[model samples]
Target: MIKTSRKGEWLEIIIPEEWDGTSVQDLFRTIWNAPKKLTHSLRMEKGVRINGQGADWTVSLNQNDRLDIRLFSEQDFGIQPSYHDIAILYEDDHLLVVNKPSNMDTHPNSPEETNTLANATAYHLLSQGEYRQVKHVHRLDRDTTGAVLFAKHSFIGSILDHMLEKREIKRTYLALVEGILKVKKGSITEPIGRDRHHATRRRVSPSGQKAVTYFEVLKTDHKQNLTLVKCFLETGRTHQIRVHFSHIGHPLAGDLLYGGKPTFSRQALHAVKLELTHPFTEEKIICHAPFLDKQNIFTGIDPYSI
Candidate 1:
């Protein structure tokens, strides 16, 4: 996943044999689905180049013509490094993935906040001579622990934003919910909207955006009245898993915000797996985050066994 904050970046691609006869405009329209804004921007500026010369939408392509396009760019946010620990899950020239701990915000919500995953990642990158700003692709609640991906440049981030819109990125979470659900497996298709009465709460509403979550019971502890489940999200929304499970009377353990018992300090949710295709390499990448050892949430079973 090419989640990043950098913009005005460039990408180079070789025209394939099958697209030899297609015009540059056709290629952008059909193959890349270039947004109108991008196409317009490229048209106005010398943003597109074929081989080594300036090219436009009307230019014809060949078997090995190189095409370069400039992607959208955004101004620097100027977030500073906090020099905190960020467990590096994967790193490369274009991307970085890390395991974010609970009690840490993914990114600072305000200018006054500095202790966030983004700030820590900035510090780490700077230590390695990465002077560019940090760009995170997704958001995890302050209490949600799991794999968060970042893009080192703006072009990669743009690709990732498209992937997110296309539902190409997959995230799997392990949750310990309060009750042993009657159904072993089920799907929650609900519309989630901000709670009108409470500024920070969400609820199922007819006018809300569509949200879907699929859950499978991994283990059940009837003695403790807790159930370990694997959750797959179909839509990325604020507190989707917590709110959906709570709506069905099985709020996550320690999720007091959603009517769950405070068995742990925070919500009993861990983003265990993330899978996506690399934007540049086209290779499938999968990342996993191990459960926090000290939590003791999985008291009766070895988490590895599951």
Candidate 2:
């Protein structure tokens, strides 16, 4: 568990018994998920410490030794805040969950792309007088709308990211694909890799990293030749759900990149639910985003029931 102290905006966590003889830096990298780029600044700036004193990177830690790490400041991000209407589904001092709108990039891809979810979050944090770093735990595609989670600072961000890597943070998506699923529920265990034929696309390949997606058919529209499916991801990859479903001959509607027709302006996908156990509180937490438009295919049916 982690707690904050008022003295220096440092987050504190006690080393557990399992990590009794581990090096400080190694533990930070593995358990805390601190990236290598942050290591130099963390050391030179006295950003990390143990037992109320700056400790050596290779110092062995004892159980119950308190470790503190300084929070990354806002200026480090180097992005100007841009105002945009964003819906915050949940918020705590440690975490922020936003219902990201379609067509908005989850984070900035280039210098020219300032109007992104990160920029909007920066503006929101500034308005709240929280001049600290905004770190997204995971990413949603530009045209996919859903719950996007962010950590308010680096320490929590690291922990949350570790949880994500461990598959502790569960995400469920609603996808409208262009076919009637023959099966009620099934798993797609396919490896995905960069498509050499298409520069920006991914395809199922044996040389690629392992990817798995599970789906349950929720509803079918024979007239539209579409089926709404609830999807669970076992692994996260670039365009994983879209690519896997497309490979199974059910490309998401409007996903032209994957051979889907333009029935909708963008791919018909939404991250409807997120469930996880709070790292600090150890309590179960779940958040959801409501449908943006009632006119969509899932108007009358309840997603929870399905």
Best by lDDT: 2
Sliding window of 10 residues with minimal summed lDDT for model 2:
1-10
Off by over 4 Å in 1: 1-29, 38-47, 68-77, 298-306
lDDT of 2 at 227: 94
Question: What lDDT score goes with residue 76 in model 2?
Answer: 49
Per-candidate TM vs. native? 0.84, 0.80
lDDT of 1 at 279: 61
**CA RMSD, predictions in order:** 4.0, 3.7
Summing lDDT over every window of 10 consecutive residues in candidate 1, give the lowest-scoring window.
1-10
